[model samples]
Each structure stands twice: as C-alpha cells, then as structure tokens.
Target: MPRERILELRHRGRSFREIARETGCGYGTVRRAYWGAGACAAATERSG
Candidate 1:
C-alpha cells in the first residue's frame, strides 16, 4: 500500500482497523505502518 494513502486515510480519522479493511492489509500492519511513519518523521525532525 502507498504510504500517502495510509496517511491520508489516517488523517481523515480512520482507525487502524478501518484502514486495514480499506487497504486489504492486516490490522497490525496498519498500526505498524502508521506508527512507523510517526517514528520515521520524528527521526527526520531530529536529524534535520
């Protein structure tokens, strides 16, 4: 799944379960992807 789509859906107030259903991915995958994006963004902010 595209990261942008995941972020967009999340931004629209979709839950991880909803995102997983919409994207045809597992709930854990959706949660991890969302959290991983946050972690990466935080790392980028810290680095740059």
Candidate 2:
C-alpha cells in the first residue's frame, strides 16, 4: 500500500522529503520504496 502511495506521489513529481512528510514515513524509507519499486519495474520491463 505504502509502496503504491509512494510511487503515486513520485509520479506526481513529489520529492522524497515531501513524500516522506505526506506519507508519514522517513525520508530514507520513502527513497528506498521508490527506488526499490522502480528498480523492480525496470527489471520486469527489460525481462518482459
């Protein structure tokens, strides 16, 4: 749920800090979620 929210916020052009604040997560947490999900998506796209 949070990963999706984080991605949504990112897609809306929110910075990591803003995402963290909006989502009530730490900056590192938001960054990790965004990058981790993004990496997975990229890998899936490449493989697919």
TM-score of 1: 0.66
The clash count of every prediction, one per candidate, is 0, 0
Q: Candidate 2, residues 19-47: lDDT per residue as tens digits?
A: 66665666776777787743233323443
lDDT against the true structure, per candidate, is 0.66, 0.64
Model 2: how far residue 23 lies from native, Å? 1.3
All candidates: TM-score: 0.66, 0.64
lDDT of 1 by residue, 1-48 (tens): 656667888899999788777666777767777766432233234435
> What is the C-alpha local distance difference test score of candidate 2?
0.64
